[model samples]
Target: MPRPTPSPRPRRLGVAAALAVALTLVGGCGTTSSSGNLKVYQQEQFEPGETFSRMFDASVSQTCEAARRALLSQGYIVTVLRPDAINGSKNFQPGGEAHVQITFNIVCTDDGNQGKLSSAYVSATQDRYTLKKSPNSASVGVSAIGSLSIPFASTDDSLVKVASETIPAGVFYDRFFALMASHLKELQMDAAVD
Candidate 1:
């Protein structure tokens, strides 16, 4: 009995088969799935003129009044009012032990726009506070068949300052400018009537 020898053609075909499989695997590795949503995020940019160049062609008193009216409309408590400046603040209690507040300070410059232009400098300060609970004792005593004194269940809560930041100029000022514009128009109408 004699063993049959392998043919050279078959060996070549086997090599070709292995090479084909290797090529297929390598080709599949370079492909990626095309079924995903992609999004690009860019930082917000604010123009300097848009942020601070809001000018109302009205008198200082009229412009300040407009700012006051605008602040009042947006639930701001007007704390300080002057001929050239307005200050307002609002408080928010979001949840337990958390308190947040934003204060708006607007300074108007009367640079003699022929008494026609008043420019408001807008800025805001954001403050956050947390409530601190402290236990206090009241006079505790017991009087039989008479008034009985008990420990106070009421806890005193004081606000502890946590953080504060100055808001930068941006579209956050657009509303203020819009409000001032509306008020300026009304003021002009009033002056025209007088």
Candidate 2:
């Protein structure tokens, strides 16, 4: 027995479907406005500490988080947050007591269609030292002395600069909306075609 042939309408529908798929693929490839698809989220900051060591951690955490949030608002996805220690030292006072100094590390990551884009480790530290005087000393003993140290403190500055320079909201939106308008133009062109 001879098999029934497929209807012409079915064959036309199949061709139309294939053509739609091809057009979509071509459109996606030709369009450079992937910027509109980008998304930015919030930034995170670390905690503060009482002591030098803890303060160092706090500084980095706070700064890095701020940077992360800024980037997120610009559509970058944060992936990591970690601290790096720079140097440790001791400060000696006239009385015979010593203080310790420490620094912190900053790391952040972002996700994109291409891959993960990450910022470099930004470092920040805050150190405090207190000196104690000997009671036996005849001279009026100093009650206490204090000092603080911070390294890589400029991370915040750099982050701010980058954010301002890279993600100007006015400029970004203008370009984004313009690209969208162009896509609409393409759609209109397609619609006008027979």
Candidate 3:
């Protein structure tokens, strides 16, 4: 007996089913992550002595002044200086079209003993930028004719901030604190001598 041939309808349906499954998987790939990223705030521990603050044996004004000098010595531009607070920033161009800016903010508070003991709390933020180029557009209108729009072939380049974050506590903070301490010690010695 001769064998019968398979029907064309079933073969076509099989191909269609396979294609649908493949498309469903490919579509899922382009989907974005969930909106639960905002929950990252829950990760903050706010632990003490981790990296953002330290104590100094001086008045609030003295501690702030020492921080200012330490920043200036390292080529930071001091933007705000006060008895209890200081703000400074420095720019860096490591290489290529990348640029970095580090801004330091310091707050000094009297620990106790009529300003004889003080504490310094510092935080540094790093902002990263990259060069970006955008195309320019030109438009001209003539009374004799209709309005004309032209796209300029030239590119306009600018720096765009890409990322910003507060520097975590580590050797970077350690070095800064060490420098500030040295400056504070110098100030104390000068006062003692005078």
- On TM-score, the leading prediction is 3
| Better candidate by lDDT, 2 or 3 | 3
Worst 10 residues of 3 by lDDT: 32-41
- TM-score against native, each model: 0.65, 0.20, 0.71
| Candidate 3 residue-wise lDDT, 57-122, digit = tens | 889888998899999999999999888999999999997889999999999998999878998999
Q: What lDDT does each candidate get?
A: 0.82, 0.38, 0.89
lDDT of 2: 0.38
Model 2, range 85-190, lDDT digits (tens) per residue? Answer: 1222222233333343333233433323233222323333335455433222123434574443334322221111111111222443344334333444454465
**Which has the better lDDT: candidate 1, or candidate 2?**
1
Better of 1 and 2 by TM-score: 1
TM-score of 1: 0.65
Q: Which candidate number has the best lDDT?
A: 3
Q: Arrange candidates by lDDT, descending.
A: 3, 1, 2
TM-score of 2: 0.20
> Distance (Å) between predicted and true CA of 183, model 3?
0.4
